[model samples]
Target chain A: MDFSGLINDFGPLTVSGLAQGAIIALFALGYTLVYGVLRLINFAHSEVFLMGTYACLFVWGLFGLDQNSAAPSVGLMLLYLVIGLVGAIIASGATALAVELVAYRPLRRRNAPPLAFLITAIGASLFISELTGVLTHRNQKGVPPVIQAKPLFTIGDTTVTNLQLLIIVLALVMMFLLDRFINGSRLGRGIRAVAQNPDSAALMGVNKSRVIGLVFLLGGLMAGVAAVMYNLKIGVTRYDAGFLLGIDAFAAAVLGGIGNLRGALLGGLLLGVLQAYAAGLFGSQWLHAASFVLLVVILLFRPTGLLGESLGRARA
Target chain B: MSVSEKATFRSSGGVRGWFGRQPVWVRGVVVAVALVLAFLLPYAGDIPLLGPQIVTEGIDWPSALFNMSYYVLLALGLNVVVGYAGLLDLGYVGFFAVGAYGTALLTSPDSVLYADTGWKWLMAVPVALALTMVAGLILGWPTLRLRGDYLAIVTLGFAEIIRIFATSTTTLRGDRGFASIPHPPGEWGGKPIFGVTDAVPYFWLGLVVIILVILGVRNLDRSRVGRSWLAIREDEEAAEIMGVRTIKYKLWAFAIGAFIGGLGGVLFAGEQGFINSQTFVLQFSILVLAGVVMGGSGNMAGAILGGALISYIPDRLRGISLGDTDLYEYRFALFGAVIIIIMVLRPQGLIPSRRRAMELKDREKEVAPQ
Candidate 1:
């Protein structure tokens, strides 16, 4: 292992890792939320994020924003960013809802086996991803570089970029708002009730299905935000962009303790930093494997994850 | 077990009922006929059922048949895990890689081991099977404690890890691949047994292995081990309460599944005379799982039919022109849609087993009161 490479690059690794983790944390919230309510993995959440990337890109395309196009002036860039975010959020939320209604709810109604739900989810995931693949011809779409990386500061051979600061800050704000929304709203209370005890929640007039739908909507919105962040940060998006990253995000969710909101944030940041360090010590190719091995080890020791599951609890 | 069971038995009143009503000897004759037709299926392109109007022009029938047989083997193996044992294994391809890499390492001249041992491909077959089974045990031992979807994701992780090992490591050569893998040796009379000139021999060999697997699997399915698997699938808690040794039986299913999947990989290595990470993508595992679910899990015939069609549908459309692009480009998307449609329409599968049919019927009965 390249110990010196890792030790020497610790500052850059932390900065970059947390920035990367922010996207994963946002992405993982969708998986965590749906899992909290439905207790289903919602395999197509990755595709929900996948759609968001394209939706934003397609919106940008409408404004004659090709990859080679020079960045617009400040006002236009802000307008472009706003337009993209709105488009991405709507597209992602709609897709998630459609998946719930079309692919999942029927199985839920029939009380299909868990395996059936997983298989159907796999089908939906593949169908949507492959359709995107066909449309994009399986090519990586170079992001139009709306957000350029400007160096914020340098400390002892480490440089923190503006992009990193923006990603981390944006992610934290979204997470805080979501936490407050879930913990402080009537609908959120309904979600907790349904998650805690579906039968009792129904008896108490919680509108369990609507709560489930609301949970999916919230998850989708977060994924859309993640997709935009990912595009800006990575400078590339593809049909399978959500796929590889989704694996990382899923690992983070599981690491934080699946079905727990704050846990996903903790898991995402820890996993991202750990991965960056591992990549420095080992190689970049080992990054994906490292995350999984970490997941396996964590699962072995504490399957509930670093933070305990809290979707359903007797919290005052 | 009792007269009530026999008296209340509802024979599905359909073509299946008529077919099921036939005497054992007659059914045996029908099976033999079907087998003969299956053996001759590779030549359907040459038969010209409706003359040259049927353009079997682009597809090499033998290769397509080989692909189908390969999938059938995978389906049969996966059926043991997902179908019988009720384990959701999303990373079954990991075992497949273990087998292929095992065989390749032993027989391929490009591999480091080839310089030292230089074993024949056939010699590696048993070693490959054993290696995959051990790998299966290792993976199952830990992850089996988790719940269903959790188990699935862990398995999926295992598959990706295997692929990464094949991709990133210097050992496996990544995408460059191991080439000139020594083919299985031997000849019959004057001709080579499964020669490299045509894939027909490989298909025939695959057929032989598939038949042996079906026979072995059927016997096991009817035995005590199979009963344990069924019990575990039906209700794990109930099975555990009933002294079923759920974990042990689940491990057995997993190991056996690995063995069969590894065997398929070995055959693939032998036929292709090459091995690569690209050949063992995670999608293939999902496709195998899809076959089991779509074909009718818990039924051997259903698995066989499902596996064949899963491969065949794509193969058949390989060269069919669609405006500008070939149909092959759209096959996976179409296949995905097909799987979703099938699961939505008939979650029980096209040819569901008697037990599963009964379960579904019982569920419907419960849904609609008398």
Candidate 2:
């Protein structure tokens, strides 16, 4: 079975898989964080990612960022990308907050059971996807091409796209920042405290609602960044983009031991790499089946997921 | 403890007391009213602005009734698993799919798999039901120990796996579903005796099934078995503490629910005469659940009404043509809004069960005595 060829082909596949994994990790983080506090899968998180992509697209169009620039100016392009990224982050953050406020907060306030919340999440997801489709009036929109880096960076016959490198690096940076937030910051402590025991955290003078909102905000911001990176890599956007992507991220979150932030990142990478290998070994048509099978297997053996703890447990 | 104490009715007439205590005649009137309405519906189009054509258009009362009846059957089936048993089966449609495709493959004129067998079409219904029940047992037996959303997620994966497989099979006609399965035997005495020529007989079939299901579930709920199920739903550990066989009860709930779902799928396959995987999507599962929940969870009447509401709302809205504003686009938005409203305002459902009603009223009484 050509084991050496498969082993030799691993490095390039690893990089590409890692790049896809990073995007999923970012989205998975949002899911895990929200679930950690609310014990509800934020079905709309995929739409948050979708919104971020649209926000970036809107910003790019406003700034006339497009291909066909003969001038080789990396610095200016970087600045433009930064603005677009920031614009997307802010918009997505606001959108996420709005969704929580409109769809979720009331249910939480009323102490509706988890099933109700799940239904609400599904509704919010459908609303946003349909809303996006209605507003954009475009099924597929082109993402403005980023300024290219010279494409000869080959490591063992595997050519890496400059865009792929940027996406992976940025995802890592965001993960690090997230780690610092969850582990090092005062708000992060409150988040952990609330997740551990909401009643105790409330006793400790933490505003539980505010901490949850902040989680959503931070998660939204990460989803926004992911949206930008995803768009840049895939080079297009669609309204119905979030459903499958959202399910995949949810799978990743569960795979990683849902509610564990680092676990989400790890799960995403593992899933991405696994799928890439599956695609390489078999074909792309098997991707969805492979991912679902992987999740079912993991859940069957380790119900708490690979991370061995769940926000679902932490929430109550 | 106060609410729970009040819920314990002391009247010891038992089953007879349960039924005789109610205004039995009132329920009869309600059923009679429905029948009368069914009889009158085809003639309702005679009124102006009401458009007699709406009722006479061959798709009127019978179509709506058939659709509602089919959904009621589906909802009642779903209620057994999700409501009485308290098991969240997200992939319930998988059972439905199995029943549907099972019947189709068995009875289908063109199916290569069963072409040599020459199985009777009616025989396929029972076989499909048995197969789907076995599937439920196979899937449920292993994962029944998982609680709440975990159970929901696993069942959902099972459903998706079944769906993906169903879609993948080009031989079962795959995406372009198997079509033109043999119809059930037609009319006797100018009316459908389990017939296939017109939609009206299907309506009658669906209506009869709905009544039988309602009566069956209601009976089950009142019997020793029903009490065991409710106890399990309320607290499985406690039920087990009291020597109730919780596993048997739960497996019973799941199997019975899948059995009913299989029946509904058979009817669905029979009506359409074509079967495909897309008919049993996750969305349909959600819709089934929405009906069960929006109607009172454990209430048979509520489930029936909820099914009618869910199935009819979309069809009604689909016909609205408002001068370039194609309201069909807003139909799902409206549907979502309705579900949200129902969840927030009336979580107990439209027509709650007798026990639920009494309990809820008692809770209110405890909260603020009248």
Candidate 3:
């Protein structure tokens, strides 16, 4: 109804969308990578991400950081971020590995059907989230806000939170590193080989289990980083937070093409931006609905994903 | 020899044959016994023959019967899509919601949604089915081409969208939901049948629907349509090469499944006396799926049995107390444990379908089958 206000408000919406997209994109990488290698949708990946958030919140609480307290110097904050990132990665990586071992490896060993795996995934997902709920005592835990950059820039009409900019930047840095790792490193080569043809990869002396473990660890690592960044942005974390966010990330993965790494990044950003635009045009309530509507539309026409390969070869 | 001759040979009566060899009276006796047992369950459940601690809390026959029949319909509907056609429709509840609300929209005494049109009770059946079928088509058309995880993602997205729309829309009264949906027209057996009045009518209604659905699906499974569907599920490319229109069969499966789901939705709505989005969450979809899995895929009897088990398990658990401790806190954990145990011990389900048994067994053989 008001064009001027809409125009002025669009700036904040775009920035916020970018930040949200960045976090989703970060989580999407783990999903895309695991799907690429194993062709199994890791339903527990979201829980892995949730574990990261809780790890950060726990660390923050342990440090007794408060919202009103002045942020420690940037160097100290960076050190803390590094430690938090590592802890989150280890915790999430171990959790992912444990799930795979307990729930998945046995099924695979028995040569269980894909449906069996899907069922197991669902069970593991519910168990993880419910366990988290019980462990956290069903309470929302707050993450002491990370303040790195001063709120120094104003683009057009909205005040931007410094934490938002840092999250986006941090996500980008981690993504770049991940891209390099996947596209450049020797382990990445093994991963690609396994994804291309597991039997052949094994024939060629690629350790199948090791490669699978590495993929889970890498994916878990990304989810962990995403958790810290997400906590920093949202200020609070809960066990069920992963459920909605996981669905959104899963949608993004599908939107981009389920197994394509670049697709995950693009899809996450696109979904986030789309949600922000939808909220700006309509309202916040329409956010989830709009994302799904967009997802259905995209999937119907471009089922392989935006950057996905042809359907025949995408089966891996 | 043609396929039809082979099928006939397989179905013919003899000591060597698997199908028609079983006597008709065996099935009749089984059905008769089951009917007697079901009716007699209330007497058995309420009365303790031996001692106070010797017996456990038993399911209320009326409620148990009602739930069993309701879920039987739900599971059968899902089986047509997921088990027979191999389409993982996470948005199955969308059709259910559509049917429930479709009936509610037409039959509601409360204000809103359709202000101009007068209340139409009987018309809601076909209308709900048609609306849900259309919704199924709209959903299935796009996602049919996608397989495996992609199909799952799209369907899940659709389900969430439906939920969000249901929750956010002002016309549907959002979270509060529409209450006091009018009862179905005419009383069963010359008495009021709506709104929890004597579970007998509802139980019979559900039983009749289940019979019809089971027969319909069983016949369909024997038809050319079912063959095409199975072919598609086995291998899309192979099925396509065999001249089966994969897309057409998939869409048909979806529509038929949704139509059945709509039927179940209407029956359920009539029983509840009110319907809302809360009644059709994603977890309900999972519950239906679990029933389908538990009953054994591609088996009508299995689906019904699974449905009955799933529907009754919660109520059965509700009455049990351990040393003055309740099971509410550990309900979900127990639920997860049940699924995992079933999958591990009885991978093929309580009553494995013929095809599913073969498929799973063949795989077992490949991995050193006993």
Candidate 4:
């Protein structure tokens, strides 16, 4: 209904969109990895991310950074950031592993139906999110002013902030390493083999269960990074924050082709830009709706995703 | 929920063995007794011995009945999709919302449609059902092509989209909510069909509607359509190869499910006499799904009981004190635990269908060495 906003604020919108996209792209990797190997949705993956968010915040709190505290010096900030990342990655990866062990492994061993896994996953998710809600008292916890937004430079009339550049650069670097790990490593090959054909992979001596665990671990690690980036960008976190973003990341995963890693990256960026444009066109309240609509459209047009190649599958 | 003796062939020494060996009439008596207890339950909460444990004393019996019946209806509706058809519909509440909004728009005085062209609550039910069925078709058209988790996410998105539209739109009035919705008007003898605090009539109304739906669904389940759904659920590709119209049956399942879900929504709107976007949360859908799965996914009886228990548990916990806080506050946490534990212990559910139960336990039929 409104084209003027998009026209007038195109540059700023693009910058913010790309920055947000980086976080989403990073998060979407988990869904893609898990889906590629297990063919299960891991509905509690949001809790994995949730644990990371709170873990980082708890670490920052231990460092005595409250909302009232001023931003730290560059050296001190980098130290806190590294500490938070470590806290986040550990918490998130552990939660993911626990979910796999407690919720998924038993069902997998029993050869339970897909719906059983979905239902159990939902239960575990509810349990974790509700536990967090009760602990947090359902309040929005503001992150300390860790990475203040300062314009680093202008690119083609777009004011690019240092924070945005940091997010984008960090996301890209992590993704590159992940891509290499998943593609070039032995563990990654095991994951790919299992994804392509689980029975055959097992026949070839690949450890199916181990590979599955590794997939969850990698996904969790990416989600942990995404959580920190999200905190830096949004400046707020809540018990249900992971859920809201998880939906977006899931949409991105689907948009990119669920099992394809690169597609996830592409999907995340596309979704972020689309949402920014949508916010410009409509009010921000409809942002989620816009992403969902885009997802539906993409799904309708290309059900397998933009790049339909799964990790080890022969592309059709 | 108890295992009957004859039904416990795997364990022939315990209480089940004796119960199973009893004559046919013995089982009939058990059913008869259960029926009697169920019929008497709404009144039994006032009894001295059973009052407090059975229910919180002085609580509204009819309201409790209404709540249970409503959830049962939702669970039954969801069962058609998730249990019978095996579709993971995470956004089933979207259909409920559609039904409610359709009813509200047509019947509520706050609606523009009501102001321009008013319709009574009774007249809105059919319209609501049709609208909800159409909504289901629209969602399923693209999504039914995808299987399992993909379908789950799309349906979820559909619900969120519906909510966002409701939230952002000026016509729906968002949080202000549509209120003063007219209830179904009529009288029995000289008495009104509906009255404040008299939830019995509404409960009875819901019961009647549920029975009709159950009857209809049972017939469908026995018919070719039901067979098609079963085939689809077991294996979609295999079913398709067997000449079953997979997409057609899936769409049919979706529409029928939506119709039933819509009926629940209509009843809710009529009973509540008001509706806002708040009532259509995704958790409500999950709760109903849990009920269906908890009771026994494919079994109609299990679905009904499971649905009733889901609502009944929370209401029963109300007014009961635990330390300083109310026990009801922990209802969801308990519910989550129950789901995980139940799924792990009894994946086939409380009143599992013999076929499904056998299939789940089929793991023991390992191949001998060739």
lDDT tens string, model 1, B1-370? Answer: 4344433343547666666667899889988998898788767667656523332446677887898898999999999999999888888889888989989888888888888867888898999899999989989899877767667778989999999999988789889889988787888898768677788878888998999999999999989999999999999999999999998999999899999999998988989888888888888898888888888889998999889879887876778888998878888788878887888887888888767887887776554211
On residues A1-316, what C-alpha lDDT tens digit does candidate 2 reach at each position? 3346447778777877888888999988998899887777776788888889888888877877654434337887788789879988998898789878876777666555455666666667766777677667737887766656445488877888787788888998999998887877788888888888887788889898798889889889999998888887777789877666776787788889878888899999998888777666645656666777777777778877898555434332
Off by over 4 Å in 4: A314-316, B1-37, B56-61, B363-370
lDDT per residue for candidate 3 within A110-201, as digits (tens), equals 67666666666666766777777766778987666555545758876766777778888888888889777777778878888888888778
Candidate number that wins on lDDT, 1 or 2 = 1
Q: For model 4, what is the error of residue B318's alpha carbon versus the real structure, in angstroms, after optimal superposition?
A: 3.3
Decide which is better by TM-score, 3 or 4. Answer: 4
Off by over 4 Å in 3: A1-6, A66-76, A134-137, A148-150, A155-160, A309-316, B1-21, B35-61, B111-121, B185-191, B195-200, B319-325, B365-370
Candidate 3's residue-wise lDDT over B319-358, tens digit each? Answer: 6778875664445556665766676666677777656776
Stretches of candidate 1 off by over 4 Å are A72-75, A154-157, A314-316, B1-10, B46-57, B364-370
Looking at model 2, residue A7 earns an lDDT score of 75
Q: Report the lDDT tens digits of candidate 1 across residue range A93-196.
A: 99999888877887767766555676687788888999899988999999897877889899889999978998999999999999888889888888889888
**Backbone clashes in model 2:** 1
Model 1 RMSD in Å is 2.5
Q: Candidate 3: TM-score? A: 0.90
Q: What's model 4's overall lDDT?
A: 0.85
* Candidate 3 clashes between residue pairs 3 or more apart in a chain or in different chains: none
Candidate 4: tens digits of C-alpha lDDT, residues B244-357: 999999999999999998999899999998888888877888778878887888889899989998898778777767788666666676677778888887777888865677
Candidate 1, lDDT over the whole model: 0.86
Q: In candidate 2, which residue ranges exceed 4 Å CA deviation? A: A1-12, A65-73, A135-138, A147-152, A310-316, B1-61, B118-120, B188-197, B236-245, B352-370
